[model samples]
Target: MNIQNVTVIGAGSMGHQIAMLSALAGFDTNIHDVNEEVLKQARHKLNKIMDKWVGKDKISMEERDRAFEKLYFTTDLEEAARHADLVIEAVIEKLDVKQDVFEKLDKAAPDHAGLATNSSTIVSSLIADVTSRPDKVCNMHFFFPPLVMDCVEVVKGEHTSEETARLAMDVCKRMNRTAVLLQKEISGFIANRILFAIQKEAMALYEDGYADFKDIDKITRKALSHPIGPFELMDLSGIDVGYYVMLQQYAETGDPKDKPSKTLVDKVEAGELGKKTGKGFYDYHSRI
Candidate 1:
């Protein structure tokens, strides 16, 4: 199916960037958030990002203007998604919350519209049963910093149709992302499952007093030839996000090890979320 009218639910970092990508690809994109303040901030952030891209010669002024012309923001979910050909949900990672969104989207969105979740860990199967249109539901997981991250995982849930999967891959191609198709559902999908294994080991090393977090980050980056270390990536992804995903996994599998690390839980409880909150494993308050 040709997805020309795109709607993104949520206006957080991932949501706005995905919406921007849709607009840049010449799709009519609508970004929706429950809070008007968040929508306003997302609009400002998109403009600033476009300006920076233009300044760096990454995109032309005409490209920026054309994207803006096709992009819009709204506080109403139904209003944003009613006519949309695809609704990408980029909200928080809680399963219940995602299910609520899918339920609402299934009711509000056009019948032919495909519903996709940008969740990193949770699978669409957990959310799809809430709606009657399970055949049209799938997971289109985007990595951190969606603008720069070129890989997007198009995951197929139990009821997701081949057409839905193909349409998702097509949408990824339109957004300049390399689509990685997963024929089966897994909790964290491909990239995140591998990254989470690294995270578990890194946390274990820190707890064992093998190395400080900074040293661990430095050594992993230097020795492993990685762009960023596990701790740093965790901080970038939000400690709370990791904590909740871990908890969700633990709940699903009853694995004691899947329970969030004490350090992560403590940091999240203390409200040291990540770059968004100005603090995490590393402090961005001073750096930025």
Candidate 2:
């Protein structure tokens, strides 16, 4: 399948970068969001990012300009999906919200277009049955800060066709990303499952007063040689994102142990959603 036109639904942290990558790959890319303010913010943030890339000699000025030329921002979902050969949904992690977006995409996107989700934890199988084209639906899970992250998990849903998986992998290659194709559906997939275990242990230690969060982070960075500690990474990725992922896992398994930690719940309730919100596990307000 030749994917010429790409559409990204959502203009938040992950969506905007994914759209930029598609545009950088020479695809006609459209980014859609319900909020015009978010569309404005995405455009501003993307410009800064591309400018940084040019300054670092990662991409030429001409390349940045050409990529922006192919990129578009919109508030209309139908308009965004109408000409798309592939549509990647990067909306909130909630299952009902994703299902609603896929149902709308099924109605608006072309008959041959492939629908993918950039969800971190929610598997596409839970979402595919809502759309008529279950065979074309798969998980194209891109990590946070996609421009910097090189890997994409192209997961095949229970009903997803092999062709759809191949098309997703091809799209990843076009974006200069390494794609890891998973044959079966699994919640949280590979990287996150492993990361969550580390995070869970970190949180448990912190909550039990066995170690301070900062000390725990320091130990991981110094002792374990991790570039960033679990707390720092959570702050970078948004505390609410991990909180929601935990909630989803709890919902699926009815496991009380899977619930979000008190620290996460408290941070989310306080609207400290990480770097985006100026405060999460750490305060970014001082830096700003």
Candidate 3:
């Protein structure tokens, strides 16, 4: 399958990064958002990053210029989807919001256009049921900083066609990334499931006074050789987002083990929303 045009819904972090990454890989890319200010900000941020990459000789000046030329950002979903061979939804982490997009895509997109979601938690199987053409839907979960991260999850849902899986894997490869194909649907997929399990346990330990948060972080980094500790990573990723994610998973499965740690929920409730908010498990107001 020779895919060319890509339409990314949602101009948030992942959506913006996907647009940048796609443009860098020479696809005819379009990013759609409801808010014009967000679309403008995403474009500006991507350009700034690309400029830095060019300055560092990471990408050729010609390629950087071409990347800018390849992108098309707009507020029109139908206009974006009508021309796309692939449509990737990276909107808010809400079922109704996602279903609404799928409903639009089902009507607006070309028959050959395939759908993918950059969802970190929602299982592909559950979301695939949103569309009449479930065979066309699959997961293309990209990691943070998609322009830098070269790994993606090409996840297959229950009704996902093998051809759809191949198409996603092929696109990832073309974009100069490694794609790990999940042969079956699994909640949280691989990385988040394994990583969050440890994180949840570490939070439990800290909450129970088994260790101080900082010490837990230090020991994990020192002993297990992880690049960063759980709380530290959560702070960087945003405590509120982390707490909400775990809670969402718990709400879905009703498993206490996967529930949000009280230590985390409380901090988020108090508006200590990690790095983005300047205070989480660590103080980010003064010295970093």
Best by lDDT: 2
| Per-residue error (Å), model 1, residue 203 | 0.4
Q: Give the alpha-carbon lDDT of every model.
A: 0.93, 0.95, 0.86
What tens-digit string does per-residue lDDT give for candidate 1 at 1-288?
878899999999799999999999999999999999999999999899999999999999999999999998998898999899999999988998999889999999999999999999899888889998999999999987898899999999879999999999999999999999999999999998899999999999999999999999999999999999998888888888899999899999998999999999899889998888999988898997
Model 3 RMSD vs true structure: 1.6
For residues 1-288, write the lDDT of model 3, one tens digit per residue: 688999999998789989888887889999999999999999999889989998999999999899889999899989989888999899877666787888899889998889998888777667667677889999999987688788999898779999999999988888888999999887788998898888888987888899999999999999999989988989886776667677678888898887777788789789997887899888988856
lDDT string for model 2 (1-288, tens) is 878999999999999999999999999999999999999999999999999999999999999999999999999999999999999999999888999999999999999999999999999999999888999999999998999999999999779999999999999999999999999989999999999999999999999999999999999999999999999999999888999999999999899989998888998889999888898778898987
Query: What local lDDT score does residue 274 receive in model 1, on the 0 to 100 scale?
Result: 81
Instruction: Give per-model CA RMSD.
Output: 0.9, 0.7, 1.6
Which pairs in model 2 have colliding backbones?
Answer: none
Q: State the lDDT at 205 in candidate 3.
A: 88
Model 3 CA lDDT for position 53: 91
Model 1 TM: 0.98
Model 1 RMSD, rounded to 1 decimal:
0.9
Ordered list by lDDT, greatest first: 2, 1, 3
Most TM-score-accurate candidate: 2
